[model samples]
Target chain A: MAKNKTFEEKMKELEEKVTLLESGEVGLEESIGIITRAAAIIKELEKELDDTEGKLKLLDLKTDEITPLSEDEA
Target chain B: METYSVSQITKKISCLISADTTLSGVAIEGEVSNCTLHSSGHLYFSLKDEKAKINCIMFSRDVRNIDFLPEAGMHIIAYGRVMLYEKTSTCQLQATVLISSGMGILHEKYNRLLKQLEAQGYFDKEVKKPLPTYIKKVAVITSPTGAVIHDIINTIRRRNPTVQIILCPAAVQGSAASGELAERIARINRHNLADVIILARGGGSLEELWPFNEKELADAVYASTLPVISAVGHETDFTISDFVADVRAATPTAAAELVSFPLEHYLAHLSAQRLRIAQATTLRIEAYRQRLKVLKRPAALTQMLAKNITGHRSNLTTLRKQLAKTAETMLIMHRMQLANLQIRLEANDVSSTLAKGYALVKIKDKLLQNKEQAALHEPIDVIFDTFRLKAEIVEIKGETYGEKQNI
Candidate 1:
């Protein structure tokens, strides 16, 4: 469920939930609920970062073919 | 002397040179020697007649104003000012204008064309397009053979590894470079392949760098829908393309930096944000654990209940002790009162009175409590503490006499 949320929304929700849990006024069940939700958000954020991790590439202007760009070739 | 930084001392020396009128714009007549035309289109040379030599730099912009090239051993009067160049901390001449005899016509033509273009609003700031904030791809138009393309590519890849670089090769300088550059720019725009365009070339002499100053390239740059960044020469060089483009970078590498986002910054920020969330959550959980340990109770409901119960348990203990003590005291008080009543009952006992040798009078087995109950001469018996005797009614002195009776 949290994976469907945008990065910004997930981050905002994670912050709010963390703050609520940190306030030390939550009930045991609700603390557990916040922990569960926060875990999901952190997982989603990690996945998003993993998805963004990509190698450099070069796109040929003439043929429009893409290829991985090595350091020496670049 | 007061303590000053290197920059501060250089500023002081520069101020002294500019404030004096003699150093203002004096033309020095000398034979030019050691003339090295730097790739940036600026001439680095020394002007020496016979006695002394002074270094001079005619910047690329002023190079366009000059009629002839400055070579070693040329007799000329260099028109410039002498000032402390802060970067090198040396006094040198910044030559703005150089005039040679018999050839002053080309600079006039260039100036004339520049003024005409300016009048036509080709260099208008209002016409300049703004670059995209998040450029996904960059269309670079330059000669593909040299280090300029490699520099641009390397700079972009270093900043953002995943950004698309669409290399649109065009001749950077020649008789035909201007037309080719304009055509490539229009083609790149037509393909709609990139967010921004970088029109670039390595530094060269003013004549070699003249392709970027042509009107066709300027027109193509001014009419581009996407933003254009012109990187024509080194830091001192400026061309007509530089004015018409939205942004002018000093070098090809700098143009690449302008278009590509720095992935390091975002990645660092992302890592820091993740760390903050993790640390904050960990701290909160640890706080709960510590709270549980200190209070020896659950956080929400049982914590308060346990507190109340402990308080009430102590109070109940104290009340129990107080109640037991009060009950014991009341019991002692009642026992003392009972003992007093028992003593009073024993003191008024008839047997004890009899034990003191007083007799009880009885007739026909009825004991007379007072003399009014007795028949005077009935066969009567008298009882003492431990003895009994038979008697007759000889005398009744107390009954006839006035002894009071509670009858």
Candidate 2:
């Protein structure tokens, strides 16, 4: 089986890349490239968040049927 | 003889016995009585018949193959020479073969010993201590000039070079060896130098390794605070010490290997620990970084605020414009509707009909439209748009001229 990279490792690497890009010390040629890579990582992180949100929504949907009656009806 | 010294007399007696009787091996059968196994690995006992009894002695080397314990009251068949002890001036049997009466006696003795130890809780699993994975220091009790020490040292050095070895030289065989071994073990315990102790020796015949089977040595091993590893004889060789020690290894080399950890295994363990720590730290940093990133995004905040303001202003402006347009359209429509209604009202006006040239004669407020209904000389009102005349119907004129009239 292939080894899996943990969430922390991936996040740390992306954060480091972002820091290097934002430092403004790198040459312009490399800066753009690093920014592009950082943007991709950010997209991946966003997708992960979206997937988690979707799962939570599914859980909510599963339990959405049991609504309470209004005061007037009761 | 009367003039001879004591030494001369003893020497003369010894010579006479040696010359008179020949030393020969013999087999005798009797019940063992007053049996004693000395510390020197020698057997001292008495063989008794119905009417008589004889003393017997078996040296350590001769009794090497006796499988069962030789005890008093057990019937045994013995083979050895009849020798005379000059000091005691008694003849006795020097036994070689001391077989028990039957298997029943040996089995009973084994069960009795096992039961006694079990009752004392010696075989309880809870009393067993776990062996250390890496022994920092190991004390070995064995003969100084034996292959056991050399083998243990070689195996330990090859496997783990850092472990310290302490040699406790003691006799490993013979009768006195058991007491010596127990004493040395106690001494080691008092010093408290080593983390573990290995009672090791090379393979030997059963009788040669009988010292390790002594109950005193077993008790000493059991009572020692330090963990003991017993490696006596070969793989199939088991003794009382083996049962009492914390761990039992088949050979000296195996005992050394069991106590020490290889350097490679340690390095691997350290590496795995480092990886876990590194991964956990990285994850923690990333989690904080992500939170910071969310906080640092000013664009999202500004965009959200601008969107809210724009939406609110647009909604207010749209509401206002719709309200004004609705009011204006309603006013224009209402005005047009009012004008149309006025036109309809004028079309249905009675005054307009009157202005269209219709006239009538009335009696006060009642109009008379039929002239026949008017009586002659009757006073009536003439109604017109401009004039109202009071007149009397003077004549009844019928069929006058071309039109019929009643006036």
Best by DockQ: 1
Model 1, B1-407: lDDT tens digits are: 77899889889999999887767787877777888888998888888866888889989988887767876655677888988888888889888877542123334555776888889998888888888655667888888678998998888877776567777777887779999899888877876767888999999766667788788888898889989999999989888889888999998988988987786665575566566656756777787788777776456557567758978899999999999999999999999999999988976797889988888888889876677766666778898878999988766555443446544
Residues B1-407 of candidate 2: C-alpha lDDT, one tens digit per residue: 36987667666766665565444667788988888889999989999999999899999988677986676666788887776676766777788877766345544654565567768876566777887544566777888666787788778767766666666667898889999889868877876757788999888755567788777887788788888899999999877688778888988889989876775675464445434434544555576688788778998677658858978898999999999999999999999999999988875674667677866678646767565776878888876677778998887654455454444
lDDT value, residue A49 of candidate 2: 30
lDDT of 2 by residue, A1-74 (tens): 11143333545666676556445456656755765665565455444333311110000113322122221210
Candidate 2 has an interface RMSD (Å) of 26.4
The CA lDDT of each predicted structure is: 0.77, 0.70
Write one digit per residue (lDDT tens) for candidate 1, span A1-74: 73665455776787787777667678767777877877777676565544423343454656655455555652
To one decimal, what is the Cα RMSD in angstroms of model 1 from the true structure?
A: 21.1
- Kindly provide the TM-score obtained by chain B of candidate 1 when compared with the true chain B: 0.45
- Best TM-score among the predictions, by candidate number: 2
Each model's TM-score, in the order given?
Answer: 0.44, 0.46
Worst 10 residues of 2 chain B by lDDT: B269-278
Model 2: residues >4 Å from true position, as ranges? A1-74, B1-115, B302-407
